[model samples]
Target: MLRVLTVALVVTALVSPPAAGQPPRPQAVTSLLAGMTLEQKVGQLFVTYVNGQRADEEHPDNVRDFGVATPAEIVAKYRPGGVIYFDNDLHDNIDSPRQIAGLSRGLQRASKIPLAISTDQEMGLVTRIGPPVTQFPGNMALGAGRSTTDAEQAATITARELRALGVNQDFAPDADVNSNPANPVIGVRSYSGDPKLAAEFTAAQVRGYQQRFLTWSGVAATAKHFPGHGDTATDSHTSLPVVDRTVEQWREMDAPPFRAAIAAGVDSIMTAHILMPRIDPSGEPATLSKPVIDLLRGELGYDGVVITDALDMAGVRQKHPDARIPVLALKAGVDQLLMPPKLGEAITAVVDAVKSGELTERRIDQSVLRVLRMKFLRGILTSPPVDPDKADAAVGTPENLAAARTITDRTTTAVRNDGGVLPRRPKAALVTGWGENSTRTLAKLLGGKALPTGATPTPEQITGAVEAAGAADLVVVLTSGLSGSPEQQALVDRLVATGRPVVGVAVRNPYDVAYTSVPVWLATYSYGAGALESVAKVITGEIGPKGLLPVAVPGPTPYPLGHGLTW
Candidate 1:
């Protein structure tokens, strides 16, 4: 039985290993480290950002206002092992993949070692790469569709596109189980509430990236926010979430997907900023807890790179001195320090820690060796820098878009169609929640009035919308985060009270259905233009709905997990 295997995994995870098994360092990596200074070795542990725009240019609205550094400047001074790309880097010129490739190449050329060019391209809502890159449905949709092959295909395309754009590391396929429907951050980013299904999907996604090479140079996939960010209701971006599960409960519910990811030979596991009190009684988040990280390495036997989540997150930042958090994380067994608040301060702190006997040089070498070994294995050490001329042609091709469409089409699920009110090209009114109308394809499809009822609509607004939509054949309420927003629930309740047939479209969160009694309901796990358009097509019977429900909706007669209907 699956439970037996899961139990065995937990038992193994609980027993700490004597030491993390270090992979054989490549000769180049060995020679490079042998000749490196302590500061250079410490620099190899950081993966910071680079500005695509001019250093003199004002910080873009989307980018963090952290101290800016040119890729070349970072290499010369900070000597970071890697550089992470963000929307600010390419949002201005996303259509030009060659330019992105040029950025990656320039950064690599400036580095002493081949930098691990990385991004947070989790495909759907979390994608760092902008439009034209295939925006496939996210993890919740993949879980709803119940197809491992589709999940693998999506990830492969993601890897293919990212590698084409000269990014080799993708912090994606969020392995968290969405056990708590109200979880603020992990909501639809997670695959399923069921650990077994999430684990299978996680493994499939890992295989997609690791097994399928976009370039001969390949890509590395990271299974992220480890020890599960699912059960907690807090967002680690703003505060530290305490996961109160006992060790056994975590092994059963939270650890399976990670175990499966490790089994699939994942390239990296990013630590969560959340604290697991049961796993380690010491009042420390997993990011700085030796017992927790040791459990992952010693018991789980994950020898691959152990990356930390963004250090700028409040969960860790508010807990430690800004300059010292990176050092503590490195001491806690993190190999890659991602997005520290101050790049120079973090590198300097680590160097000072070593000199002050707070951290040993041997300990630093252990992490640096692991980092070097990964770079070597990924072929970044020997592979030529990404060719700018070939990047645009390879990335965002029609073939890749078609693959993304195929995945999206299969993932749009119909959760409810009471009295068969769907699959009709009805005169429908479009009512939206926050950021719901990035594309007006749904409104354009219905040839109806577009109304913003607000994220939490006023009763007057809802009633007015109901009156406004009186002439329409159907009322389509596009709701987001309704499960957590009572005001949104009131808006949906009033709309459903209208005489017209009401179709509840859970725009971003599938659990939005639990808040309303709409005659018909549908769930689009992503707010991407393609995903929104796919929902419109599925509703109009242009395409059939194939996705199953990845999470349960609470009610007296609740829609169970995997409950999906097709006309």
Candidate 2:
């Protein structure tokens, strides 16, 4: 038998019944659920991806995958409850904010019910939308700032831009604690290594994302990779990773941020594609493990929409076929199956499961009701078509950009300044390292020459950077993935050997400092334009170093969490 949500939990946890004039009437949700067919109900359980920017445009990938040439045709045929936008090779669903708003309107026009448009706009490395969208340095940057108000402000700006673009759902505020130094996937994506700090930032971001704006109901904030994807050395995108934390360890390390998110009334929680032997020995990933989900539903009391990570990933596909994955996830108490490998097959399998009595229609109704209630609560059902013309005005305004710069400025962490090399204005400087764009930007800002190198620098590139450093009084080297790349570490060592004052700026991972012996070390946590500009200002003594280290860097002498040097 499928586990059903208790009425009290449904009322309190799932629906979050409004105070006065808020929406999602229980009767209206019931009426809508009563009208959906089994196929329609099953369709509501999957959030699929489309290939084109415009709903009416003919795209070859859409034709090949869905037997339809246009997004509108796919929506009409499949009637998916939601669609996620991605800018990958298969799907180029974003161009400009105005274009996205128009596409969203067309897709909603094609569907019988309004669609919940979503994207992974978690800022920093994972931000899907770019440019005219205000770019804030991501979560770890926020973690370094250690200001809950800044975290909320960043989320509020992001929510405004996303809502203006007609996207209503954000897979954001990662909420994972980066306890393991070698975690492959979630490095700077997490807020902090300390659970309590991560928890505080998570709750603040939730409130920011869900706060209603003028004429716009709030965007639905999702606290993701539930149970926790941090503390693992492997990446889930390639294969399943096992986290061996016992129940007590998990509660102490991984559960605090999720718990804080729940108390902050996050609209949804996304399950990770990881297996924990201590939590569930059934060999199923958390996305398909009922026992693991019980920890969220039973122990944590989260009855909100439980969404699975992308179904096409290798983590959840182990030993399970494409069709059976969706069925197992639904049985495991997941409300939404995200980005299934084969959308039609996944939907049909669930419908067939209901027909064969393996899954009941009542169980299907429960999830659909939860989804419908969220759609109603977020004003997706009642809101008018997004105005494409006003999208540019709403997104990336001057005020919002200034706010983003302020937040990024506060996150420039000075991990080490042995000779007080930072906050020094150098007449002649050489800027070189990983991240070509970031190096060029910093060089332009600092009035220095830029010799940009790749993440894994070639020997020739290292020699060229070393030659360039000889002509300058100071050298600024940007490093990324230094822990794994000895060549990049070698480049930093060579630049330091030049006998010039060398400042190593880690633009991606702050842990790069642990692998280098540079006299001066700083972490921007991001290579975005705003972050690089902030780093330049700190180098020139325009601003003091204020950011604390969000994660511990291990070495012969370790830099513990919350360590930073201020001048």
Candidate 3:
């Protein structure tokens, strides 16, 4: 029976609900905005991007030059009320999942209304579709495994593999609160530095991406970069990152996970080109600020759908240029402008600013009636087409890689073992200041020997990994920032001066255990092969390291902010 109602709606989105549900009736968005017009309600406030599925043939996974327009000329001339996908439209013609469900059923069969097709899956390491799906273990390893039912079963298996590839929006649970452990783009895509434990794992990843298909047709989650790119060290995807705190230290650390992702009913939030300037001293960067979208709709009451974040970043493209960032992100109230970098000069500068009154066709029909009321509360206007052969049985389903290896074996963290040097099985030698398939998967999970160093390692590859760590018995470095290079702290000081039991592992910044003085340290906050197979089954003990330090690693171990140990 449709596989027992998709297994009782994936076991009711794997438990963990408790609150926030309401939000869907706007009377089919007031009778579809009383039959739209003004250039189709300014193309329903644009959620643009095509990543080319044949636009005069330029494939190689398209996103970088938008292949000059083809999915029937972006659905017959920018009728984009939504469409996001990337990684060049599912690897330019062959990323499977039935060729991205026939390129999202040919852009919702050349849209007129049913569109909102988004992606940026946010599976560890910001995956934008490419793989047999299910990657999980993101948001600082679910805030180092303080699981909210493993962040609502990894956003209900990444919203049931983005609804079998027709992708009904998921920018994702990055409700940023990494709280600057030198945040250059929300470390471990944040789930903590404790703002009520990143607002209880951002309301358990917005009830695992908007209540995992409660009775069907779902997805839309978002809650991103808003009001806080987690205490920025600048990288609003190239430049503007300021956040100088103060609305009571940003309501005690970046607005409590965007007020628990708008009380967990998050159908979309996004914003944040970072520049709080103490909550808008008119420095303008909360995507062009009207006191930061009126403090997310009059002091965080957030009536959903704000979006912004990628108006071709350089923090709002080095201060607005390609026809003033979609009419100053819809005069800073922003319902959605997402990837706008001259999508026909931002829809002819919002239809020449509503024919020169500088904006106001009833403010573009109140942001295209909040983007057609979140595509009619995510049913994507009565969903149907996009069964490109049930996307190979709804992508990577072994019940979604056993719910992405049970949330990457509960987020791997053993923060500094010190002497017991981690469930030892050694004969190992796997060093990597750069990933060669994470030095051949932690050297075939420790039957070891794979030294590949290049993320700046040459003093004869750090004296050949200090003479292959003097014929290994134990020496596994794997890093992605040990102090981001002096040849990765001269290859972790020549593999901890070859006093062999050295461990290290930080694979993609858990602040590289504050520049390694390693006696043993681990943190698979993402390099993703299911977080390096849960850091090789927590160093061969076959998983037994319930991860903890969800941010705070400054020089010296005592790792703080929820550090982990567990033998």
Which candidate has the highest lDDT of all?
Answer: 2
Q: Estimate each model's TM-score.
A: 0.90, 0.95, 0.36
lDDT of each: 0.77, 0.87, 0.75
The alpha-carbon deviation from the true structure for residue 161 of candidate 1, after best TM-score superposition, in angstroms, is: 1.3
Count clashing residue pairs in model 3.
2
Lowest summed lDDT window (length 10), candidate 3: 3-12
Write candidate 3's Cα lDDT for 309-396 as tens digits. 7777788777557678789878888878877766767777788888999898987887777776676566676566678788878878
What lDDT is obtained when candidate 3 is compared to the true structure?
0.75
lDDT of candidate 1 over 173-286, digit per residue (tens): 799999988798998899999999999999999988866322343578899888789999899999989899987898899999999999887888999999888889887899
Maximum-TM-score candidate:
2
Residue 369: error of model 3 in Å? 20
TM-score of 3: 0.36
Residue-by-residue lDDT tens digits, candidate 2, 346-460: 8999999999998999889888988877776676765666889999899889999999989888999998888677788888889999878888899999999999988888999
